[model samples]
Target: MKHLSDEQLVFHHYQVSDDGHSVEAHLAGCEACRARYQALQDVLSAIPVTPVPERSADYGRQVWQRLQPRLDECVVPFWRRLFERPSLPSLPRWWLAPAMTALVLAAFLVGLFWSRSRAQDTLASRLRQELRQELVADFQSALNRSQERSSNALAALEARLANDSKAEARQLVQALHDMLGRARAEDRQMLLAMFRNWEEDNAAAYVTLRQDLEELASLTDKEMRRARSILVELAAQTPPPDPPFRINK
Candidate 1:
């Protein structure tokens, strides 16, 4: 058999009943259970209870009398209290649609203005970019043209300088040739003049020898013929004068 629980004994000691009568029957038959219930009753009886005080019928009147002066001192006017609470007045059913329509119209207007401003900004930025691109292209084209002109000018200057240098070189060579030809002609003329002086001196000596030979007729005729032949060979050996030198400029 199951023993009675302490909760059942506690409820019984308080004169409170539960859903079953098993605890009362067990207390009557079991001495241990009955003694436990008696001990629980004794402990509950030993604790003291604080009693609630009763008020007289005039308690509310007394409290109202004491708080009335303070309430009056802190009281606000009707208009001041109305503003502090800030309650909205009731609106007619017809007002709802118009209020919502006004709110939506204001939002649409703001969106349209914002979109227009954004589009204007985008168009301005595009125009500025196009202008900048055109300016850059123009500058690049001008620079290319300027560079071409400078290159052409430099090429012409180089060609002119080359032609002048060639002309100067030709002139210098011609002058050198003329100088060489003149020196050769002068050397030839000096050689011819030296041979002529030698011829004259030999002729005078031969005349004196002939006179002496006439005086001394003891020489043989064969020796005289040999001497005359030698003199004729010497005169034939003299060279002619050179021609004048001419150089084309």
Candidate 2:
């Protein structure tokens, strides 16, 4: 006789069972078919309804007799007969179904969100680094640029101080010497124009000069202080900028 197909073995395993001789033969001789049958059995077993209550042999005969009238009436179609017992085959598949569901849920969450794993840093530590880098860089760049502008400005101040009618004034002479060679020409001319207009009509450049002066003053006091105070403790012993160049006749 021809051997049974897996589908036949599966249906037999679930809705019905083959005899012990066929089961043992399949297990001993055909491992593949036997494994498939066992898998089908596991899946089917997972969705177990209340086991049909054991009754006397008359019970099956009674069910057959009741169904025979319905069969004759053709009240239920063939497909409906196929599903007199509900089956959720996709759900209870030998542990694989649960695993597949979990895998899909995990993939969806991962697709929706990219969790930033900062095993590289602790919470406060990461915050500190981010703040330090951002604030320090901003402060440092602004400090350097303002200092550059100040160097140019201090130079012009010295030049004018040196040229004062009272050239021998102690504070003026000292400041002139201290500020020698620092102010750039462009900056000096700019400052001169500012001062000249400040002299004329005094209020002519009020709004324009007021805003400029405020910004410059803020750089000098607020921003520069914030930037410089950060470094004061780090190198308190170090001397200030050395002045090596001298250009005067």
Candidate 3:
């Protein structure tokens, strides 16, 4: 009779609980398999189960008492928070759009409000007064750099959205989702509404793409030819996702 391997013995030990017929048959006919199984049993038996110590009732009561005051002070119940919100003024029908537009403009202004201060800083003014003054030009150049950076960011976003890889596309979408999730609730809703418009426009733009391809192909210019060549290269490489909005169930 052939002796079992250590792996076989370990497996046999596991199956022993369920009545291993092969383990019994091998052990009956072979000394080595039985010795291996015994070693497995000894190894397994040495492992220990540790039990958690229980606290006395007095200790648990003290912990609860300590937490109770903190919980009372810090955590208002959901119902209280819901009812405690200041009652908003009854808004006019036209208030929502104007309010959002104002908020966005205000935020934009707040973000860039330091540009004028920086340009007119006492040190900056003194240095510039001694030198040539092209503060307006400096502002224009700064603005141009900002515009370029913004355009580059948008182009990168567009390229990622157009990319073929599902992982990259999902990552791009998830980044937007996470950013919108962290925004203020009212701001988030306005942003979502804005995004819905962009999505609609994108859907419409794809249709316009198919139509414009024929128009683009028919155009008479070297630039138009180059555009068609690039478009054709893109279209040939990857067809858009079927049921484009269906990202998986």
Cα RMSD to native, each candidate? 35.2, 41.7, 51.3
Task: Name the runs in model 3 displaced over 4 angstroms.
Answer: 16-19, 49-249
Q: Compose the digit string of candidate 3's lDDT tens values, residues 5-84.
A: 77767766667434468668879888776777787889977988587899886997899999999688777678888789
lDDT of each: 0.88, 0.77, 0.80
TM-scores of the candidates in the order shown: 0.31, 0.21, 0.18
Worst 10 residues of 1 by lDDT: 13-22
Q: Any residue pairs clashing in model 2, and if so which?
A: 155-183
TM-score of 1: 0.31
**lDDT tens per residue, model 1, 164-226:** 988989999999999999999999999999999999999999999988888677565766888
- Cα distance off (Å), candidate 3, residue 187: 99
Candidate No. with top lDDT:
1
Residue 115, candidate 2: Cα error in Å is 5.7
Give the candidate number with the greatest TM-score. Answer: 1
